[model samples]
Target: MKKDIFIPKVENVYIAVVNEYNEIYNSQDWNAYIINNKDVDLEMVLIVTSGYNEGKITSTFRKKLERLPAKNYAKIELMQEELFALNNTFKVSFFEGNTMYDKTFLFRKNTINLKALQPIPLMDVKGVLVK
Candidate 1:
C-alpha cells in the first residue's frame, strides 16, 4: 500500500503586531474605518496588542498602519534583519506610559519570562509570542 503525504501551506508574508502579554487581537477593531476605502490592498495586519497605557493599548496604531496599503490599507511590516537575527529564544521590550517610555525584556532557551515587562514602555512593542 502507498500512503500520501500532507504538506502545509507556506505563509510568505506576515503582519506582526507588537502586542503586550501575547494576547490575540482582531484587526477589525481598529481597521473598520479603512475597510470601505477604495484603495486598500493588504493581506493581513497583526495587531500587536501593546499593553494598555492610561486605559488604552500602547502604540495601538492599527489605524495608521492599515492606511499604508495602496487600497488605503496598511499592514504590519516585518524586516528580515529583525526576524532573522532573532534566536530561538530572545526578549522583547514594549513601552506602556507616555513621555520617554522605558521597559525590559529577556528570552532564554526558547522561553520568555512575562514578568520582566511589568512596567512596560511606550514603544518597542514586540510581536506576539509563538511556540
Candidate 2:
C-alpha cells in the first residue's frame, strides 16, 4: 500500500495559467498568473522553469511581483507557443502578515493541446523528453 502526501489548502494567493484577460483559459499562447484572492496586497516572486526538447536544454524565467491588490492578479509570462512546448514548473513565493507561503505548480506536457490554432509549429528545443 502506498501512502498519499497531503497538501494543505493554500488560501489568499495562488499561481495558475491564464489568458491575456487574466482568466482561466486555453489559448494559442498562455500566460502564468499570480492570483491574489485575499483582502490585502501581496508581494511575490514567480520563477518559471521551462524545459525544451532540442539540445536537452532548460531555461528559467523570473519575475519580481509586488503590491498585487486584493482580488487582482499579475500576469507573469507568455508561454507554450502553440508548438513544441514541453512542460513548465511555476515556483511562487510570497508573504502575508509575516507568514511566508511557497508553492509549486507543475504543468506537464499532457496538459497542453499541441494543435492549438492552425498548422503545426516548431519546437525551439529538440530532443527533450516530456518526463
Best by TM-score: 2
Q: What's model 2's TM-score?
A: 0.60
Candidate 1: regions farther than 4 A off: 12-110, 114-124
- TM-score, prediction 1: 0.17
The alpha-carbon deviation from the true structure for residue 2 of candidate 1, after best TM-score superposition, in angstroms, is: 6.6
Range of the 10 consecutive residues with the lowest summed lDDT in candidate 1: 28-37
**Model 2 lDDT, residue 11, Cα:** 71
Error of 2 at 92 (Å): 0.3
**Per-residue lDDT for 25-104 in model 1, tens only?**
43322111111122323333323322222333223332233213442323333222222223222112211122111122
lDDT for residue 64 in candidate 2, whole number 0-100 = 80
lDDT per residue for candidate 2 within 91-125, as digits (tens), equals: 77776666666777666654544333222112122
